[model samples]
Target: MTERLRRALDARPRLTRWLLAGPGAVAAALLFAMAMPIWLPKGAAGIDNIVFPLILVPLIWAVVFVYACVEESLLRCVAVICGTAAVCGLTAAMAFTGWI
Candidate 1:
């Protein structure tokens, strides 16, 4: 193997990757689960809005997780995760309070 290839293969994931891929993915998933119910405008078929999001959130989480795993910058990863979580949590709270 080439020296570059060997080095690349030998490298381990850093703490940022773990933080983003783990907690970040969880945060994104929480948003998908909660925010949609509030943020999704009402529709003809009442269940579709909720059901469709439930189906879609896992896919979203997987995508976010993969992106987080590959993201090199700690600041970006934290921002994305915390930002998403805060938005979702706030939305969920507002909905619970009948503000939505």
Candidate 2:
């Protein structure tokens, strides 16, 4: 079972790399941005939380994408991206549920 899983994971390196660098990074970045408002200060004008995330989205995406592209271990790369997305997603969910 483990061997089959390993073979599947190793089957198409290029596709996996592209998937991680593209949609995976985008999803993580967007989730992080969405969760940012929960933690970011509202600033004097009370718009920083909104503005900052919008401004930082591209930078966030680029950084995640680059890391996914350059990381040596694919497992580690997936873990990092998925972990980030999961954390941010949970944060957003908690906020919506008024748990935070």
Candidate 3:
């Protein structure tokens, strides 16, 4: 079963890579941005957290996308992207639940 799944994924490398570089990167970036507010310190007017995440979103996306595209190992790329998204998502969720 695992061999078959591996073969199937290997059959269409471009499609897999595109999927990772596109939607996967976007999701990771968004999750990271969402969690940023929880850790970022407020400035004088108390809006730095919001504004900093907004400004960094595009850069984060680009960095993730590039890493996904350029990485030699597809599995590693997936792991990194998913791990980042999961961590950030958990952070945001914990914050929302008042656990942080």
Which candidate number would show the highest TM-score if scored against the true structure? 2
Local distance difference test values of all predictions, in order = 0.73, 0.90, 0.90
* CA deviation > 4 Å runs, candidate 2: 1-8
- The residue pairs that clash in candidate 2, if any, are none
Better of 1 and 3 by TM-score: 3
Better of 1 and 3 by lDDT: 3
Error of 2 at 75 (Å): 1.0
Number of clashing residue pairs in every model? 0, 0, 0
Least accurate stretch of 10 residues (summed lDDT) in model 2? 1-10
What is the per-residue lDDT of model 1 for residues 9-56, given as tens digits with 9 covering 90 to 100? 336447557766887797778775788877676688778668877888
> What are the candidates' C-alpha RMSDs?
8.1, 2.3, 2.6
TM-score of each: 0.74, 0.84, 0.82
Candidate 2 lDDT over residue span 46-78, tens digit each: 999999999999999999999998998776777
Better of 1 and 2 by lDDT: 2
lDDT of 3 by residue, 1-97 (tens): 6566557667888898998899999999999999999889989999999999999999999999999889987767767898999999999999989
